[model samples]
Target: MRLPLGLAAYRALSWRAAQPAQEPSAPRPEGALLWLHATSAERLAALADLGQRLCAQRQGVNLLLTVNAAVAPTEPAALHTASGRVGPVLALTSDHPGLIRDFLNHWRPDICLWTGGDLMPNLICMAAEQGTEMILADVNAASLPRRRGGWLSDVTGPCLMRFDAILTDTAETATHLRRLGLPGRRIAAMGRLSTGASPPPCPDTALNAATQLLAARPLWLAALLDHDEIAPVLAAHRDALRFQHRLLLVAVPADADDTANLIATARDNGLRSADWHGGDPIGEETQILICDDSGDLGLWYRMAPLTFIGGSLRPTARGNTPYEATALGSALLYGPHVADHAAAYARLAEAGAARCVRDTASLAAAVIQLSAPDHAAAMALAGWETVTESAALTDHLIEMIQDRLDQREAAAHARA
Candidate 1:
């Protein structure tokens, strides 16, 4: 095949310098390997949920996850999360034509989910020639490669044309691609590629009972409360109630033993307390209701629009995922110690969906600020948008990927 002038130029420049050596990796896993790529760690965060879903849904499917010249990840072929294996993570090789071919030859992925707009000419061209199924997703105009040289005829259009399908995050992005000469049928406004797990299940009867019982009281939840963190949480809640006198704090302990400490802290703060397990009555004077040690947070999340995740105040902040709150229409508040879920919290913080508190004072202030209906509503809306921005479209796309993989595997077996 004749190389387009733009692609030819790209290949020449891409290989002008010595390509970095590919890192040593283990033998590829046997099965239908699905490879995914993003330009940076932040972009890679969007793929984590997808990778986890793929790995969980189809045990036979192997994932090869990569980031482009961004921070390299340890492990290969399957992305890993705390709970299970998503797939191996690696840094993509520099776009040198030879290395590109070498990398593809080694992996031999059945399909590629390429995050859209940051087109790699040599890599795309090589992959296309090798008959790899390429799908461009989360297309954004701002993410497209900017013109560095006028002399190089635009290669983005041609590189994108190689993709089997181009799904955009918005109609504007689809329209932008159309202006680049991609056909209408080839592009669809599929919204963003983002992920959030379903909110914890809360039955309607329980939700309505709690909502009516609260009777317009300012409410906040501190869930998965660490033993040491209980004191600080109660202190913050007590401080918050000074200004918002009708405030109610619902607490859920991380461990059953932690319940004793929580009740003691509430008493120390001179706040009236109700314990779910102890069968203490919840009356108008009751300010703290300790949820039954079940640690089921769905009911509390639905009861309160403001949530402060526990365990985030310690040095080893094993914080909860912020999506659980955002997915349940609650605004998030966490502490300085969120290394485990830094990307998720960062994403939410950037969008004004979450707030970070350094100490009890800040947590108290956040609670007070969120007490106002308008303020809480705005943050809740932002949380909903930030966490769920691309959830539906991404879910559909994931299903499509699975179906395609299944079809290919079935055909391959027949051929064998």
Candidate 2:
């Protein structure tokens, strides 16, 4: 495929190849390989989530994540799932012809999901020449890449023509793409893609056993607890206990090794505590269940109707995302320090599915109020709805990728 004049000029002037990646990846494995490129940091998480969903559903799908960012992250590493290393996460700094050639020749992905549309003419044109099934996702006027050669006759339009499909973030973006001469059939408005993950698995046996043992006690979990949060959390639990004596607080330390210290802290605060690993029954008198790891945090989310995300309460920025808890039907209580996951928490708060607790007093109050079975159930419903808001788009992507893989497999067999 001959490059357009703009791309030709870009190729001519593009002498500086991409830097040698710091990490060495294993040779590409056999089977369908999906390459997802994020044009910036904000778009990376959604692609990463898509990778995780694919891995969970289809056992052997290979994923490679690349980023074309203004700056490389301080550290770049492999994108790992529970099974193991999915693939290398590369930061593609330059799009010189040589760099693009080496990348396409070496990786030779079965399909490409080019996200946020910082269109790399060299990369896209070369990959299309190789007959790679390319899809540009979440394209908007705001996200389109503008380069030096953009002033010349048409890099973006001709370059985008290489894609098999273009998914825009809004109908307005679809119109924008049409203005650039892309056929309507190739473009669709799929609102902002989600970083939706499959809910953490909870074995039926474990869930049933925990349910029977607890016997429907009012339960809440303080997940990913930091060292500094120990006193305040236990105190909150103690205070909430006055109103709801049957309340159970499941405290999981951020570090498994801190289990002993948390237990000691509970004892010092005159609260009854039992280690989950200690083989002690969670009787009515057991005020706190000290869990060592958040590994089984899924089970706790199922057992408890409400959860307080940890890092938020500590003297730091936001806690971990509450999506996991929401996915598993748990309402959320969090602190004001939620910079990391501000958007997610903000959504939940607006929906009344989550509360932002300012201190020990507020945390205790929220636990006591939200623990009502009806109230918690309502919030959990809202949370679950919020998490699944982007389900239709997610399902479509999964199905599309699956169909792409199936086509590759069938084509290979036909050739054989």
For every candidate, C-alpha RMSD to the true structure in Å: 4.0, 4.1
The lDDT per prediction is: 0.79, 0.80
Among residues 3 or more apart in sequence or in different chains, the pairs in candidate 1 whose N, CA or C atoms overlap within 3 Å are 76-88, 77-88, 78-87, 78-88, 79-86, 79-87, 79-88, 169-191
List the candidate 2 regions with Cα displacement exceeding 4 Å: 1-5, 15-26, 40-43, 52-61, 74-85, 145-153, 213-216, 242-246, 274-286, 293-295, 315-321, 335-358, 372-378
> Please, what is the TM-score per model?
0.81, 0.82
Best by lDDT: 2
Clashing pairs in 2: none
Deviation in Å, model 1, residue 3 alpha carbon: 1.9
lDDT of 2 by residue, 75-161 (tens): 232122211434457778667777677778888899999887677888888899988999988787776755565422477778889
